[model samples]
Target: MTLTSQLTVGVAAFDRYLAICHPHKYALVITRSTSNIMCILPWILPTYVILGPMLGWRNWYPGIPCSFDIIFPKSLRATAYIIVYIVSIITAILYLPVLKTAWRYYQRMNKYQQNQTRDHMQTTNKMKKAILGAKVTGIVTIAFSIFWLPYMTLSSWIMVSPTAKSKLESDLANWLVFFGASNSIVNPIIYAWKRPDVNQQFKKVFCGSKPVSHVEHIKT
Candidate 1:
């Protein structure tokens, strides 16, 4: 929940980067109304995709999956689980490429190999908050893979299987779920502590001062 909201906020920051920091193309490509629509997509899509679907799907299937209503009948919850799992799988596929590309950019930048001039290096440094961003993203994916993915898969099997899960196994999962949900809060905290520029920009952007404009890429 918080993770979705924060990602939406992060996208807003990205839009600001493109508009203020990359004004040349931004000027050519986006009018204020179009920019407004672009900015809304992150928040709007999730609301429609994740939240809306879940709520609406509950009418068809009387239970919510892996959520508070998991205590409902097996048949009801099973359908809900399938719905949620499909959505989660789609989420993973979309983000996997994003994460891979960010990692490559991070490695290339840190290696000092991206056709850098002095001014170019400075601009890249400022714009690429993505190393830390990628870390956060990777961590979320890992958590999803570990905590949710297998559970969803197994539960699908459980939907059919007569063999019941032992108390120890279910207990362990219940205990670990909090750690999985911690990803959202953890990302900001880790970035703030480890990345000085991100911390500064974060304070500048949200703490009353005008945020620094997104920097243009420098020509060599």
Candidate 2:
């Protein structure tokens, strides 16, 4: 589930990159079918990693039920972490151009704001929203990195340095695992904090607010 979440976030970042960097081609490239495929691919790609032990690609540790430590070899586990880091790097790369473009748009909007017509105002409003959305996504990405990096680094260390494994390290790894899992809990809060629509729906569902009609909008 964590792997799927990370990959889905990466896909979302990529989607925003396209929307901000290549607005003209984004509509044609990111259709309904394309969106479906993007959604499915994240889940599908992680399945193999999750199911590798059951599929006999790796052996589980004896007397330790379903532990990640011995499920895959040290080399394979290290490789998986490398893949995850690559995804993180790529997500960061995609955001750079988006931030640049958003800043440029903001400057242009501000320059014309005093004499702006209705159409320009609307465009400025959209640019503001887009900038907010990008910041929200960036926050989520940073949160993922904060929560997962310690666990990944520790786990990789344990795998690579078998002699360094000790009760202290094991306990630390366990705590870090929980810390990483907390990202799942943090994500919805992040979304609600930055997104008014999501915040409103959260209130309506959890706080017994009245139903409000809203058109669904994807930030990116």
Candidate 3:
């Protein structure tokens, strides 16, 4: 859930970025009128893809409320598992380009920081901040992949390999779940830890005055 929630927020951040940075284009790309709809569709679509049929299968039976097991009938379980795998794969695939673009920008911007003449300082500073946000988005995306991939892989392998019943499986699942939970915490953590602009903007919103420096906020 932490992973999913983090992902949701990250997507929201991208949408918000477009709204702030490219307000008119947002409507052309996805539309301001349907922003909430667009935001939620990603989060909820997975359930319908993965569990909606599982729920229907339960209706045909008696006590089975939820599961991705063989007892649910071969065809149904197979379909559900495939749905899960496909969704997980698609999620990973979808994020790859985002990570790549973010990484390149991050590297370029980090390198650009070595020089800042007064004449081009403002322009470079703005570009650097833009790149930093992309870098943060990439990190958040990678963290999400790291935390969730194991769970998804295990799920995919559960039927083929029965080795998942070991105590180590429980431990791995426990830790993964914890990491997933960290996703929600990360939005704030990234803001305070890695993103000075976001933190300063937040401060201005709540503290009633502008902060002096990005480095100062980061120093804490």
Highest lDDT among the candidates is held by which one? 2
Q: Candidate 2, TM-score vs. the true structure?
A: 0.85
lDDT of 3: 0.57
lDDT of 2 by residue, 71-154 (tens): 767776776688788889999999989988988886876687689888866655666666666788899999999999899888
lDDT of 2 at 5: 70
TM-score per prediction, in order, is 0.45, 0.85, 0.53
Q: Which stretches of candidate 2 lie over 4 Å from their true place?
A: 54-66, 162-164, 203-220
lDDT-superior candidate, 2 or 3: 2
After TM-score superposition, the amount by which residue 134's alpha carbon in candidate 1 deviates from its true location, in angstroms, is 3.8
Best-fitting candidate, scored by TM-score: 2
**Candidate 1 residue-wise lDDT, 46-92, digit = tens:** 46545643665544454544543343457655655655555455555
| Regions of candidate 1 where Cα sits further than 4 Å from its true position | 1-132, 147-154, 163-170, 193-195, 201-220
Q: Per-residue lDDT of 95-127 in model 3, one digit per residue for the tens?
A: 555556556655765787577577666654544
Clashes of each: 1, 0, 1
Q: Distance (Å) between predicted and true CA of 171, model 2? A: 1.6
